[model samples]
Structure formats: C-alpha cells, structure tokens
Target chain A: MTTAGINIHTGKAMPLNQANVDTDQIIPKQFLTAVTKSGYGKHLFHDWRYLDQHEQVPNPDFVFNKTEHQGASVLLTRENFGCGSSREHAPWSLDDYGFKVVIGTSFADIFYGNCINNQLLPVQLTSSQMDQLFALVESDASAQITVNLQDQTVKVKDLNFGFEIAEQHKTNLLKGLDAIGQTLELDDKITAFENNLPQWQKA
Target chain B: MATTLYDKIWQAHIIDAKKTSETGEEGLIYIDRHLIHEVTTPQAFAGLDEKGRKVRCPERTFATMDHSISTRSLALDACGPTNKLQLQTLADNCKKHGIELFPVGHQKQGIVHVMGPELGLIQPGMTVVCGDSHTATHGAFGALAFGIGTSQVEHVFATQTLKQSKAKSMQVQVNGSLPIGITAKDIILAIIGKIGHAGATGYVIEYSGEAISALSMEERMTVCNMSIEAGAKAGLIAPDQTTFDYLEGREYAPKGDNWTQAVAYWNSLKSDKDATFDTVIQLNAADITPQVTWGTNPGQVIGVNQPVPSPNDFSDPIDKDSANKALKYMDLAPGQKLSELSVNNVFIGSCTNGRIEDMRAAAAIAKHGKVAPGVTAIVVPGSVSVKAQAEAEQLDKIFIEAGFEWRLPGCSMCLGMNDDILTQGDRCASTSNRNFEGRQGRGSRTHLVSPAMAAAAALAGHFADVRDYQ
Candidate 1:
C-alpha cells in the first residue's frame, strides 16, 4: 500500500469539545448530493457552521467561525467522534476541509476505518491526554502542536504525549498506499483460492 | 474447539487470513455477496474507474437504486435532478461493469438490504457486505453480513475481499414467548433500551433462544436490521428449517440437487452447544411490550404504556447529558405519556419494515378504518415484488381506501433522501430504523415504532398502542 507519507504535522488545533459528534453534524445529508468528493469542504458542519438556510451568514458561536481558528488543521474532541451513519462522506468532508488529523478520546468503528482509508489520520488518545492537549491548545491558540507518526508522539511545547496505532495502518499511511492497492497485491493468493473452490461455489 | 455460527461462517470464507503487524489481528476475509446502492456506491465506482479496474466478480455483485430515488411514483424521471443523476450514474456504472442492477421501474428494485434476501441471494454461511449500514439485515440468514465504507466497497469490487479484525461475540437470549401485540421491532427496541446505544460496540451479536427461533424470516430481518442502531458490527441467528423454507424456491436460490446440498451445509452452520461468547444477556419476551423511542436515539425507548424518562433518572453524566439534549431536540417533556404524543405523519416503510409481512401488519390495522383526518400516512413496499404481492392481495387498496398513499418501492422518508419527508417540527410515527435528529428531515421528531403501531398512530393521530386496536 502506498500513501502520501505524513511523518510530521505542525498546525493549530481546534477544540470541538463535544462527545458523540455524529456524521450528520459533520456533513448533512443535503450536501451529500454532489457526485465527486472534492467539493464537500464548504458544507462541512453545515447546520452548526451556518446560522441560516442560505449558509451566507456564519454562526459566530461555532468554533470554526472564530477568527483564531480560521487556519486550524487539527481537530480535538471528546469521545465517540463520528458516530452514527457509516457514510464515508464524513471523512471526505473533513479531509476536504483541510483537516489532516482528528484527535479524540475514541471514534466509531466505521468512521475510524473511513478516515484511515481516506489519508486522514484519526488518533485515539487517553482522556487525560486529550484534556492535556485541549488545555495546552486553549491556553495558547497560537501554540503550534506537532504530531509525529514516525515516533507515535504528539508534542506541544513542553508536553509530549505517546499514542498507539495499528502497524499496517501506520505503514499504509506513511507509504501513501490505498487499501485496495494493498489488497490487489494479494491477487495471486486470491486467485489460487478461487481456483480451488468447488464448481457450485464459484461465482 | 466448539465453534460459534460467526466463527464457522468466518472460517468458511477465508481466502487469506493473517495477523496484522500492529495489533496481531486476523485480516482479509473474502466476501460472497456484495450489494450496492446509489447513495454510497458512486464514489466507489469512480474509484474503480480511476484505477481502470473491473468488478472482480460480477456474478457475486448486485446493484440497485434506492436511497436517492423518489418512492412517491414509479416514473424514473420523476426524481429531482440530484437524485436523477445518482440513479443514472449507478445504472451506467452497472452497465459498464457487467454487474446486475435493479434500477427504478425494475421489478427487483428496492432497498439494497431488502432486495438481497428477497431474491434469495443471501444464503447461510455467506459473507455479505454493502455500503449502507443496514446491510446487517442479511445476517438474519446466519450470514456474516455487515456494512462497509466506500473504500471497502471498492476493495471488494477489486478483490472480493475485506481486511477485517475479528469482532468480539455477544449472545442475547430471549427465552420466553412474546405477547400478542409485541412484534420483532418491539423486542429489538426493548433490547436496545436495556443495552444503551453503545452497548454492543465492536461486537457481533448472535440472537438466540426460543423467541428468536419462533420468529418468521421477515421478523428476523427486522431484528438484524437494527443491530447497527445498538452499535453492533453485525447480528446473526442460526439458520433453521424456517430459513431454508424462506429461501427454497426464490429466484437466486439453489435448485434440485444443489438445493439439497445447500440445505445440508446450512444445517451445519449453527453454533456448537459448548461454544462460548464474550458476553451473554437474557431477556424475557413476556416483560416486553410494544415499544417506541422517546428521544433522538433508538436506545432512548419506552413501552407504549410508560411515561417519558427524565434526564434526572439517569445517574451517569453522559447518559443524563444526552437525554437532556435528546428531549430538547424532540421537544418533549418528562413524565409525558408516549401514547398521548400526537403525530402529523406516519411512515410504514424503509428497509427495516418495508417487507411484505410488514405491509400485511399495517394493512390489517388500516382495514379497520380510515386514516385520521389530519394525518398523512404512506405505506411503501420494500421491493417491486413486494408491491406486486400487496396488490395481488389488494392490501394497497386497503391502504389507499384508508387515505394512506400506496407508493413505489424505495427508501423514502427513512433518511430524507427523497420527496417523502416531514415538515419542520412535524412529529412522525415511523417504522424505519434510526430516530436521530434530522434523520427524516430538518427539525423532524421521529418516534420509532412497528408497522402496526405506526398504523394505529395514523388512525388515532397520536401514539396509539396496537394492543388496543387488536
């Protein structure tokens, strides 16, 4: 599997501070009508980010609407981010919105899978670690936080936090490899197994 | 070692399995049936086109247009431009890839989950996958069926395999017979209430015991269909004579010598007596009544006779917080009687409850009287075949005569994908799965119920207990 390698990322972290943030909140169903994946950034968090139906006015109360978080690329949130609905568009919207990393206490299974497949990294940190990162980011919005996938560490000035991820996923991301590409490499084995199947079982 | 039904099926479909380098987890299980829908497959087909790859096994794959099409009419051109484009893209993609597609106006067209088993394409011991989460509905046949992302969809299209980590096993046993009015939807809702929304996370549940075995094939599908709502990866029941009977003569089912051989294999798909699960839970069917969701999540449910629960009733902070938010979104007060809540709309369809049996249950109630003057009720058959069956029995006439719209087969109000939707602040008694805020429409309040309960609510213009109608 080959992927756009991401050994290190340094960016401002935006704090969402919500739990069980579902995919609908990430990207509303109405915005999912687009045929391609590229144009979803503008509609990310449609209901929360916008105050009116036309989406011409931004909701100032929203985290993303604040001036300080304009160019933020890392999202920090509480547990169970991206729950409900297995739409891969959630990650597509996030990735299109320029978020390279989403750090949360936990994530829904399918959303985590989708993020991994889409080249957006979802980092699971302990609750205390999440609190530390949030506190650090909040204390100084200008503080640049760095995530090093090579060392499995998240560093914010004096504080450094360690995280764990599956080796295969880590390798896939680092190599810019698509999952289907990796699976295709095992074609010889797959074809061999298909050949050995009974006549009735062959598709 | 005694094997579970999940393990047996998982083992049977293994083309290549190995522990991943990071977590040492099993990976790469082959899929037997890959079902596709327009809503989630467009991106996947685009991925295939980008790679210039063909569908690995066209015979094992099936495509349909459901989520983005209008269920109000059979005319394919009647859908809005966005939905029309999605349907056209799906049809074109299927034509390009040699995949079998049941497009709008086709007799086989319906929700992907519903059409799979209805066509007898989902058999016991097969590994089934689809881009939509409700694909778990096929697990009722004892298959390892689960929803997948578009990336996985493309992977399955490319290799007919998925890299998966083994899920923990959970066994839920409903040991007693249910009362007359309580249907499979009620039982599943009751279970979800007991086990909160995240109770079955990372687990594949196997529902067993007398109650499960007693349910008809359609009822079992209803149970498995909502497994994802409870956060389960998949849900399964051991294949039995009822399962075989349901599949025996269907369109894609085996025939003659193959039928006999298939049944013999399905018989061996059940779990061994000594097989152990990670968790075991038991519920008495007698303790359950007709259920309805009082909050935004399916897990926030209560019996029809019960009052709405206050956030104060929950000790956990997370539960209390979520309950408060749900109540605010749903515009409900504590201590309110669920049966007294008025509904402006009643939808008795979706992949969950759009089967022929579900239509029959609703027809029985609508036949008794007309829909209440202020209510807008719609009954959508799961598939064109189911619609044909309902028309043959004149069930559509019963519904139409009662002022309920008899519509074409598609996933309508279930997710607000089409024209069938509730206006803002409108409360609906819906038979579809998921009561999430805005699931049906913006600011729409959904109370999940069975078809009979939805019909009863339609007639009464409020949440009416089906038992009273019975």
Candidate 2:
C-alpha cells in the first residue's frame, strides 16, 4: 500500500474486546436527529457509556469511561464490528471521539466504506492478530500501536501485522481524494453508459 | 465462464473491472436508482451544498420523509421542532434538486422499500442504493441493491456511481415445498439461524431453489429485506413471471413495446445453468418452522415451540459470550419455554413485515380473538397505499375491533425514531427486522416474529405459535 504522501501515525490503544458491535451501539438512533455531524462525539456509545439518558451517569465499566483507556486514539475490537445499520454516524462518532484507526478481524461492508471516506482507517487483521493486540492493550493501557498505511502494517511490541485493504481505499486515505470529483472526470463514460441503456431503464 | 445471477447484473453495470482487491474484482458500478430518506440525507444534502454540486441524475433519484417523521398524525407541525426542521430540510432539498419526492403526507409515501416497488420505480437488472440498510429490500426484484453510508449518499448524489470491490457470491438454496403455515418470514429467520450473523458477510447472496421461486414478489421482498441482518449487503431472487406480472401495470413500468422488450431481457437475466458460486448452502423448506429471535441479533433465533438456549448452546466462545450478554439483556434463563413469555406490546410493521400481504396475514389471526386486555397491539402499514388497500379490504376494521390500534404508515415502533415507541422495559412481540438492545426504546426488549405470530401473541397475551391459531 506504499504510495507518495502516505503518512504513518501511532496512538495509545483501547480495547473494547467485544464482537458484533452494531452501529446502533456506536451511535444510537436518538442522537441521529442532528442535521450536522459534529455533535455526536460526546454521545458515542450513548447507551453503554452512560447509565442514564442524560449522560449524567457514566458507566464505570465501559472502556471509553475507564481512566486507563482515556485519550487512546486506537480502538481494538473483535469480529463483525459495525454489523448493523447503514448509519455513517457510527464512523463520524468514532472519528470525532478521536479514534484514528479501528483494527478488527472483520468489518461490515457499509461500515468499512464509511470509515474509509472519513479517513478513519479500518484495518482487518487475522483473529489471532486481533487477540494479541487486545491482550497487549488490556495488559498495558499505555501501549502504542503504529499504523503505516504505506506498508499496510500495524506494529506493536514484537508484532508487525500486515493487513489488506482495497487499493483505492488506501489511496483515498493517503491523498484525501474527492470521490465525487474523481467520478465526475468519467462523466463522458457515464453519459455513454446512460445512452446505451435499454428503454425500460430510462423510465 | 459460467455466470451467477448476481454476476450477470454486476457485469452489466460495471464501468471498469480491471482493478482487483483482496475480496474480488474492484471497480466502479453505475447506480440506476438512488433513494433518499430524512434520517441520513441532511448531511449528504449539506455536503452537496458545500461543494456547490447539483444532483447528477435527478430523475433516477427519489426522496421521502419516513424515518423520523410523526406517523401518529401526518400534519407537518405535529412532530416537534427538531423533527420538523429535519423534515423541512429534505423537502427543501428535494424541491431545489428537482427530485421526485414522496413527502410524509403523500398517500404513496411510506417506507422507501414498500413505496419503491409499488410505483414500479425499482426494476429487474437495475442497481439501487439508499443510506438505510433495508435498501436491500429492492433486491427482491432481481436488482443489485444495497445500503450505503451518508458519504456514499453524497457520492451517489454527485456521481451516480459507487466504487466497490465485488463481494463473493453465495447461493442459499431452499428446495422442496414449504410446509403448510410456513411463510417467507419463517424461511429467512430459519436461514439466519442456520448461518450465524456473520456467515454471509463478504458475500452477495442469491436465494434460489423451488421455495424462493414459489414466493410472491412481496413475500420475496420479505426474505431479502433482512439480508443485512446476516451481514450481507444484498440478497436477490431471479426475476421470473411473478416479477414481470407484479410490475406489468404499475405507474413507472414500461408500456407497450418497451414492456414486451423489457420482459425479453429480464427473462435472460437468470444465472447460467452451469454457473458457479463461491459458497453453496442447502436447506429443506419443510424443516423451517415459525421462528422467533430470542437474542439480540437476528441469527440468535429459534422456533416458537423451543426453549430459550443457554450460552453453552453455542460451541464458539465468541458466540457463547454474545449469547450470555444477550440473554442477560433479554432477561431469560435457559430452558424457559418461548411460548410462556408474556409480551406487553405487539408491533406489527416495518419494512420487513408492513406490506399488504403482511397485513392480511396478521388480520386473519386478529379476526379470531380480541387483543388481551393489558397488551397494546398496533398495526402500522408499510405505505399509504398499503394502508388504503387494507382499509378497502376491511382488514383495518378487524384489527380495530380486536382492540389493536390501527396506526398511520411510517417506520414507527420499528426503529422507534418516530413518536410511536414502547415504554421503557416493555416487552413487545414485533414484526420488525432487528431486535437489537434498546432498538425500540431504552430498556425495551423486542422479540422478532412474523405478522401472524405478532397478532396471535397479542390475542394470547404471550408468545403463541401461529400454527396453533391455524
């Protein structure tokens, strides 16, 4: 995944240490009322993070509220992360909450795409790799993980896990490319495709 | 190379296929239809405004206000200021963009999935997308339809194309005739139960075999609507006589010569006889029973007659953990009979089970008895047209007389975005798709079932097997 202008960054890791976390849990539906996207940061994991609806009582057991995991920008979770709902608010909330990278064994397709668009890199590693990372983070909250987009590798103490992502997705993160602008460059091709469409397609 | 039904549609719309990703072929796929709703589009519309971009193809795009609007009353001001502003934003955006909109008060307006097919806006071989997960509902028409995030919505708005690496194809073959009283909802719940929630991840499922073909177009939609519940972006059935007949005389359907030509092309849209799939799953239709989701995810389901399973029931530790958590949240113990569970509310609606056919099935059961005194039962039709059709057939009367509330059409009680919601800690037998923790309301629990099961549960004041009613 090495390319020009690719940047590598490291951050303290926080372990959610759970699987099948759906978007509803990421940012609940009640908070989806805003027309703007910025205010969802405080409400991320609204239900699990708080014992009350008003955010008055922070659940002490939740990782995000745990003192050790505070200020950690990396989120480590297990399989099927972001499994339900097509809400981009899930990624927006994660990005706003300062998570630079989400490493999981697998991700739901729509959630993966949403994360890429927002530059919240979703790195998929093997189940064993995830387990090791989770253990590292759990044992030492101050553990830092390096994400090298150019090398497509996540590095921690004595472990360098190479992960796979789509080439275009990688490029977009590195370049912060405008997808709409790039697609418009193919306007001629789009027009040609539309013109050749069958009569039933036009209606 | 032999082509699957999914491959045939994907190949037709692929603008470029030279790039390959870890999953499969990566390319730009053209979208023919883009559906928009209130909950996910305000940001997308704002992004478009920030870029000063016009919608690439307004005709192909349709807008609606369903998710957050008040379904109890259609009046614009009935929803609080927060919801009103969001609804206004969509209405303004649609007017400015010149996109056809089915606003909240429109008779044709309902859930996007329910209204899309009724107007013939979705057709075979077309690629459709929306910002909501149930967008997969359109795939029942043999279209390559999937949900997208808001950024993808803006991307589609500006380019009318999606950048995606093709998902591997899986064929779920449900052969043999369905047993009496088994419906499409039962079959899909059974499928999810067999394949865990993540079983279909990274694949586009093509449901085939005699059982799928026998389903009506509406019933096929019921099966495809929950594709996301199993982690698949889309699931499709091959278009056949039933599909064509359903679309034949609809408003947006092709007329005369175009109609004749459309059928000819659609007839050729099936998979090749020797087609290959990356994964194949076979299940006997006879084995499926009326199902209910006892756990949070759709995959954690069982037949109505069964007992709640313990975490030990799942061999995998991760699954075992999820089960323990879900059981704790659901407040049930292992070996507890599912039928003995009492429900305080019955919600029969959503994109999954809110169509006319769903209404008829539920009403058929409602006619036999009154809703239990303390149980609150409500039937929310999928669309305005579905509401009218139900009323015309006097199905609404049966529900009302049986003490079930006949409500307006919206995704009310399903996602609990609208005014209709369950009280905290209320247990509901619902016909909605997801039963995620707090989906209905904070501390509210949902038991997913078919419409008939929901109605029967209302009558019996507990989780009752629909087969017993029959």
Candidate 3:
C-alpha cells in the first residue's frame, strides 16, 4: 500500500540542542508496552518531557515543555539525533507527536531508515547550517521553516539551504511507497531467482 | 585487485544491484537469512497480512521468542498475559509463514544471536538480517549481519531482499597480547571508550590484527555483538580455520562434500592482503584493562580502578553535558573509584556475554563461596542449550550453591522486557550490553561489566575487580 507522501512542509521548528539524543530518551522502554504503533505521541520523550512517572506534570526545563514552542512540527537537533536502539517506536513516537521534519547534522543509520519508512523527513544539513537553524528557531519560537523534498532545499525567511538525499529514498518518499510495497513490485524477479536456486540452497 | 572482506561478502550477495537515483551508488542487496524475535516481528506480520503477501523463502527465516519471554521460570506458562500474548502472536506468525521457530522452553530456544551461531545457521559469506540490532553478533562467523527496521523486516520477509546503500569500511586492528583479567568484553568497552559512542557511525568495522585473531569463536561473538553499541553498522572477522572448526560439528552446518566446498569458499572470504579501508584504528591489547561503564551510555566507561570522570574532563560541550546527566541518573559523584560503588543486584547474562565461557568464568568466582549477604545475583543463560550445557558441567550447581539464582535462558534483565528486572533506584553490575538510563528497569542504575567482574561484584557486594578475586 502507498504510504503518506511529503513534497513540502512549512511549520514552526522545535530546537532540541542536545547531541546524540538516543532512541531510549526519545521513547523510553516502559512506554514501549503498546503492541501497536499508536498512542506513543502522548509519551514521546517520556523522561525528559515529564517530571514524574504519572506524566501529569511537564518538566518546565525541557525545551518541548516551553509554551513558546508549542505545536511545533519541525525538530531541529544536533548530530546523531537518533542513536542507540533500533526501535521503530522511536520514529513512531516522533511521528505521533506531530513532527513532520527532522533537521540535524547527522542521524543514526537505522533511525534514518525508520523515519523514511514512516514518511517522516530526516534532513541532513551541515553543522554550520544546523547551528544557524537552531539559532533562528531559538531566537523566534514562532519562526516557520519550509522544507521542500522535491527541491531538496530548506528555507527560512531570506536564508536558503540545499541538502542531499538518496535518489531512491527521495522517490520513495515522494511516491509514498513503503519499502515493502516497492519490493513487492519486483515480485516476479524475486520469485524467479528463488525458484532457480539450487536444490541444496533452497529453503 | 585486493578487496576488503566486506566487499567480498557484499558482492557475493547481489541478487540485483542498481545505482541509486541520488548518489548513483549500488543498492538493493538480497538477504540470505532473516532472523525474527517476538518484540519486533508482530507489527511486520500485521503489515504482511494487510498486504496479503506470503513470506518468501520461509526456510531461510527463523523466529525466536527472546526479548519479551519471562526468564524467571522454565515453564512458558509462567509468563504473564501480555508477554504470553506476544509469544503466542510470534508463534502464530511463524506457523502461518512456515518459518521455523524456537519458542520458549524449546531445546533450541535462546537469544537470537546466541542460537544462530550455536545451531550453525550463521555461515561465512552469508548476509544475515535480524529485527534486533545485536544481529551483528552473527558477523563473528564472517557473515554480513546487521539489524534492520520493522519495515525492512517486512521487506525481507516478503521478498528476501533489502534495499540498501554501500557503507564505509573501517578496520580496527588490535595488536599485542591481552593483560590478565582482560576479556573480549573489556576490549570492546575500551574500543568504545576510546572512540566515543558515535565514532563508527555509517561504517562497517572489520576487526583484525593479532588480538582479534587469537580469540575463540565465543569471544569473537562477544566482541562483534557490541559493535552496534559503538554505532557501527556491523563488525566482522574473516572466517579462519577456527571458524570452520567451530561450525564443523554443529547442527545445520553443511556436511561431507558440502563441508569441504564450504571450507574452500570460506578461506577465500578474507580480505585481500593489499585491501585498503576507508578508515583504520589501531589499538594495543596491552593498553586495555578490565572495563566498567559508569554512566548512561556504554562509551561512558573507564578501567576497573579508574575514578569516575568529572564533566570538566570532557573537551566537547555535548559530551560534558552527557556526563553530567549520566552522573545524576546514575547517582554517582566524580572521582569515586568504580570498585567502591556498591551494587544491589548482579545480572550475568544477555547476548553480549551469555555464553558457555562466560558462564564458566562466573562459576569459577562463585565456587569460592556464597554471594555476599543482601546481594541479589542471578545467572540467566543466553539459550536453553547453554543452560543445559552449564548444568551438565555442574556450573549451575556452583552458582546456586553460592546464592546466585540459576534461571532459564533469555534476554533477561538485559532490556527488562521480562519479569527479571532491577528494582527502581537499584544499582546493578550487569554483564549485558547497553547501560542506557532505564535499560534494565525504570530508574535503575546499570554498570556494564564482564561476567567475571559481575560475579566478583556479587561476592563482594560491590564493584570488586575480578583480578582481586582471582
């Protein structure tokens, strides 16, 4: 089935300056109890975003808890934005939490893949670009950034920055095709190869 | 032309390769084996059902119930309702797909990484993918093994192929002889400590040099298992005679003429003598000491006798901030000796260090006497077979006699998906991987150590150096 496709996104950016913000901190293990991928938005960044286990009080110190950055849809962070575990729940949490674009200097390979599969845009910018974005977002909490997937460019006011993504990944995202659906398009080729395998090697 | 070991394996597995539209790099490599576990596969199965697709080459896929299975008892019925539902879903999925499953309490049931090698399902020059990140552990046998996301898992299940891009290759060459009390765990921990947590990002590491060559298969597995902890895509050691020897008599291995041919092929899987790597890191074995993580991440570690680091010690602001947070979460002060930190629990198991050798090492320490009063020590084997072998050798008896609980095999307390978890605010010396905040249990502080060190900590009721116990 075709997944959600994104061509352009314009939204307020949330600046989380921390580097190497791992998947565990994004969505702690305790919150992974749900078998399905829904309802994770409420528990995103469970530990840092909340002051207690009951999650009733927001941690005022955390950036997301600030009222100025409320309803932000873009996440601006430092390098290795998604490190540690390969839990797809991480991206699920981010997606459910209403983040449509993640702009960072770098991302862990698996997390990047998970984000792509879930139709969340993971944009890789240079450290200087990231610093500029973080500064702009921090200075004006309501500043809106526009990310154009087709043009591979991110823009805010007069500042414009170009980025790079794998061509196939760009196509997949534009077409809203999940990897499994794309692979299924090659069913004939896959079956032919499997059928031709030597008897000893056949499963 | 010289080719790196990674090139050899990657080239061999190209069912279809095409240049990516963006980078013009080759992508779409086929997977030979797909390993599944209870925690990561349920959603994939649902996706498959939604798409009305059948599992292609089910024989090439294997499933196990490890992550969420209860390890407190041998009986599968002992698992609680939620865990039982997960286990049941996994079993049902495997049955529907015709995939072989090593369910809970099965003789072959164990941690996916541990059971793959023990059953000889992992072979040299193979491409193995798993839903779990520790799938890199299979690279010990010269396979191209790495973790994949749930979407990728569904892709592999439906087509036995993965869309991929090339990864940079790095060689970590550790030379010289290891010092006493040092093990593979210490070597990997030291490597992480030296390189920081994200040093090997976007690359696959080929561990080489004399120190790596000298390790046994189990030790090699332990080293490769933690490659992901350092942010590497995978870690591999070219199969040598030692690898062939280890696989020769195991179940699922090729036999007779097939074995002969496999040996000849495995011999050719090594990197060429003139092969060049994108990056090379050289480490001296003599420089490594027994290691223990004192912070939230695996890289926040020091030698056994080293003092906890001050945040000021870090030159990078981010690293310093991480250290400060780690210290607060771990409830420790700077400059405190790691050996002086008291532990409320000692856990000796997980895919990282839960092998027969690790068990023997812990048993050697437990044989001395009972564990120190008030220390809750438990030994959960990596697999049912490992438990059986340990019991056969009376290692379980030694642990039981020393006041350590002998439990069934699974990923117990490693990720705390099961009942075996550290209580909140409890300090634990664990032989498992990942000391991240709440990794073992919510609000629990974890100090990652070697099996011997964990056992020693159990006996001393603190982080005692294994060398002192010896």
Candidate 4:
C-alpha cells in the first residue's frame, strides 16, 4: 500500500489506540545522535521490535507488531499524546513512519505545536467522539478514516467529528510553513514594525 | 489592586507592545543577561556567523560547556569524543565572538544556571535568557528568567532583546512547617502532583508563605529550578536576609557603598503584603510527605507510602490508558506498594537536586548505612564549589564509605548527556525531575523521588521511605 496524506474526500479508516505515548518511546534515545530526521523510521520502535540477538524484530505482543495495522498512515490516539521530553524527533519519526494525521483527545503543548509546525495534522477531539472513531477502526482491519484538512473534519464511516484549527495555523500548514516561513508570511508587517521603531533605538 | 513581582519585572522590560512590522504582534523586551551552553550554542553561533554578526551585547552573553562535558574529566584530554569536540567548538565560538567563556577547570565552570546566581550575574528585576530550560533557576533571585530556542538564542545574540508574550502571575503558597523528614524536593513533587504539568503554562509562579520563607536560599533555588518541570515560565521567592547574605561578597555583586544601594533595591523586589496574582494556590506544608513518581510523567506522582493506582481506578479513560501504559513500561504492578519495589541504582544529582544541601541530606542518610551490595549509587555535586565544600565537610568520604561513587561536578545521569547512564532494563531511584522511560538511558526505568528518599532506597535496595531510615 502506498502511504501518503489521507484526505477526507478520498476516505479510508485507520487508528492507533494508545495513550500518553511519549517522545522517548517514539524514538529511543540511542538514535538522538543523528542530526536530522531523515532515517528514524526503521528504528521507530527500537526496543519494541528488536531483540538482544542482533537487532531482529521481537515482541510479537507489541501493538505496532500487529499485522493488520501495518502501513496505516493515520494515527488515532487517546488523550495527552506526546506527553514527555521536548525532543522534536518524536513527530519527525511519526511523520517518517507514514502518519500524516494524529487525531487525539489532547496533546502536550510543545509536541502539539511541533507537529503543527512540521506539517503533521494533530487533531484534537472530544473523548466520546474519539471513542466512536476507535470503535470503528477496531471493527474493521481494512477500515480507513478520512481527514480533510480543507474541511477541518475527521470522518470514520458515517460519523463525522469536527476538529478545530486556528485560522492562521490552518493557512500555515496548508502552505507547509515552519516558524521562519510563518514569520516571513508577515514580511511587510515586520518591515513596518522595524521602520516604526524610534531612530535612537534602531542601533 | 497591587501588582505581583511578575507584573513589576515584566512591565519594566517591555520595549514595545505595538505589532511589529517584522516580528508581528510580539512584544520586544530588553534582555539583561544571556546564558549559553555547549549543546545549544554551536548552531546559534553558526547562525550569527552566517549573518556576519558580532554578539550585540558581548558583556551580557556568557558561554559555558556543561551539557556534554563529562563530570569525570577535569582536563581537556580526558574529555570523550563528543565532549572534546563540543568543548573545542564552544571555545572557538566564544573566542570568535568575544563572549566570555567559562572553560573546564575554571572556578565559574558549572551548570550555567547554578553559576549564574552564585556570581551575582543573575539579579533582581532583570530579564535573563538562556539556551537552557533550567534557566528559570535564576528566578530564585527575583529575576524574570526563562529559556529560549537556538534561533531565539541567535536573535538575542544579535539584538540583546527577546520577543515574548507577558505571562500571567501565580502564587503557590505553602503554609506551616514541613514534616520532619520531608524537604524542598517533596514540596516541589507535591506541587507538581497537585497541579498537573500543564497547569502552570503561561504563568510565572511565585512561591511564598511561611514554609517557603523558612527555607534556605539553596532550598528556594531547588524549588525554583524545577518550576519549569511544571511548564511554568519561572519560579521565585521573595528576597530575604538569607538571599542578601548569600549574594554579599560575590565577585560580580555590588561592592563597597554599592552593596547597600543594591540591598535596598533587592528589598524592593519582594511582593507587597497586599499584592494580588492571576491565580493563587495554597497547600499545607504539614500535609505533604515524601513523594515519589510512579508513572512516566512528573505529574504522575504519589506520596512515598501510597500504592500505585490501577488504570481502572481513574474515571477518565485517558488517565486510565496513560496509567496502564506507564505500568507496562515501568514493569510495575497495579496497586503495588511503591515502598516495596527494588531499585538497582540510586542517583543523587542534577541541576534539580544537586545542591550542597541535597548532598548533605544524602550524606546524612548514607553516613548511617551502607549502599546495598548490588546497587550502583552515585553522589554528584552541582558545581566545583559544592564538590569542594562536600569534601571539606567529609561528605564525600561518607558517600564513598557507603559505596556510592563520589563523582565530580556536572550534570550527570540527569538525562544521560554524559557517561553516567543506566543500562537497558535497569531501574534507577533518581533525585532528578522527569521519570519518563529511557530518560536516564535507553530502555532504562526511572523512579523520581527526593534526595533523602534516593539515599534511603540506595541503603535498602528498594523504594523505601526515608522516614523509616531516619
């Protein structure tokens, strides 16, 4: 299956039922030496998948090891997702692992901001709404949830759940802007602010 | 209504409230001091070089190599591969930009946050920025201090000012006296438990009340240092006689006749009796006991005598799932007594709890007992002066006799930036913040508790309460 962005219009159903999944667990500390986020996918669950016997995949009971959930790009998690260490690598690894959208009840403040900046759609939903979505994904292995950035809604079967996106954040994500890019978007305003500063303070 | 200390300091630093043409609707505040460390400075300096910029306020910017520097190695040659490279890079950057560098073996070389206050570099009514999260430690001196990112680091280097939003003020007042065995660590852990990690977001917390006032300056610093762990912008204590005494005769502190003037100014830094805050939280000091973290996050803590709760105990499914997942990773049984759990390592160090008082507390406990045979215990002081004082007081001998490694001063095992780390699946009784899985090392299990509790655990070979040992 080709893993890419999941659009609300294209329609599919995928969900990851987990909670309080910290950044340290997402990508182990051993891989932190790598300066960039380019190759963190294979080592996503280093301890969960690997064994003492030469790094082979082990722990068949682990959640990510389940066969049916393989290659599902949309991750549906419980509340307070990404609730540890401020490592930006967590979302980087998740994005690299083909997850374009993470719908959860809530997220850590830093991680949520990070995911948004990195173009990963972190959807915050109500618990009852998330419970309904979780039930739909559990019922069908091939079921895929559709998340439309344009509509700012997540649909699991006929049940439609509305998700909020700040108008500025929505525009930035749609255009794929980081903090610098976002700042640059208001270039004229920034210039005006600089020009307005008193000449004595301009040094 | 009377304004809190946060309001007083914040209003003084605001350069502009109007929406800036370049930085948007951000308030540009003048930065009085800037601290830099090895891990976050290289990229920031590189950015400055790319812009052909000299540090705009070299006098305000000070660099130190601590995050990657090993506590074991005092000499440059003994520094490991990564640290050696980091130190060299730091030296190069500081020299190139004419910024002051606290190199290895220097008296001032310690955790950037610790050294800042000791030298009187961080003072009252000042805006301090550092590339370290624990920069808020300086807030103990009544300064408005907080951390910023590498890009912000460069911005401060070029402009000597930071663009920031004003934070709301919070007063966390703990009244009455603490229990016999409990310390400031217990107070902070209890606070983190009472208010969830994100509860203090966007607020500068001012710790007050008779209990806070009773604490020594070092004890106050410990509490303020961990304020960031609760996601607070900063934590502070009103300046008192102890604060003035500690600052007196310091290298950068006001000298001669200026000392009197400085003290008069420092006295004014305290909150007025009728000062109001955005939020006020009260806790009875006598009610708190020795606290320990049972789950991955700092907020998932309980009193040392309490049992770990089962996932089903929580009404919220989100809380339940987090508790369940934490139990799985920590290999802890639901409803199991925390005091009965065995520990393999005991670490008594970090910017959080590595002060002299913490070392003295651990030594007092370790002096009476020996570390369990299988337990690997280490006592790391916060700075060179702290280590010297420990040795002077024979505290190092006490730890060594008790089978704990009396290591040098630096941040060690406090996130495993250096060689001190727990091996895979090894559980540690840590006196640091954040018990997140693998935080001490890859696949390492961490149980966060107070220093005295860590010492008790080290002696007992399990997570036992310090009151039992006392």
Model 4 C-alpha lDDT per residue in residues B1-470, reported as the tens digit of each score: 67688777776666655643442334667777898877656766776676576786788788776666677778654646656676788898889888898887887777777777777787777788886667777887888887665556767777776656566789999999998999998999899888876667667899998889898878888888878777787888878788888888888777777777777777888777898888899999999999999888888889988888889888866678778888988989988998789899999988788888899999989987899989999988887778888889999999999999998777778877777878778989998877877788867889888889999999999988788766
lDDT measured at residue A116 in model 1 versus the true structure, 0 to 100: 83
Candidate 2 similarity to native, TM-score? 0.98
Question: Top lDDT: which candidate number?
Answer: 2
Residue range B79-188, candidate 3, lDDT tens digits: 57767777788889999989999988789999999999999999998899998888989899999999988888888888899988888899999999888888999999
Cα-based lDDT at residue A114, candidate 4: 58
TM-scores for every predicted model: 0.96, 0.98, 0.96, 0.84
Estimate, for each residue in B387-470, the C-alpha lDDT of model 1 and write its tens digit.
999999999999999999998888888987787877679999999998987888777899999999999999999998899877
Docking class of 1: medium
- Please report the TM-score between candidate 4 and the true structure: 0.84
Candidate 4 lDDT score at position B301: 89
Model 1 residue B101 lDDT score: 95
DockQ of each: 0.64, 0.77, 0.58, 0.17
Which structure among the candidates has the greatest TM-score?
A: 2
Model 2 spans with C-alpha error above 4 angstroms: A1-6, B21-23
Q: Relative to the unseen true structure, what is the C-alpha lDDT of residue A159 in candidate 2, on a scale of 0 to 100?
A: 86
TM-score of the second chain, each candidate in turn, equals 0.98, 0.99, 0.98, 0.96
Q: Please list the Cα RMSD from the true structure of every candidate, rounded to 1 decimal place.
A: 1.9, 1.9, 1.9, 5.1
Please give the range of 10 consecutive residues that has the lowest summed lDDT in model 1 chain B: B18-27
Q: Tell me the spans in candidate 4 whose CA falls farther than 4 Å from its real position.
A: A1-16, A33-76, A88-103, A112-123, A132-203, B18-26, B49-54, B75-80, B256-265, B270-278, B468-470
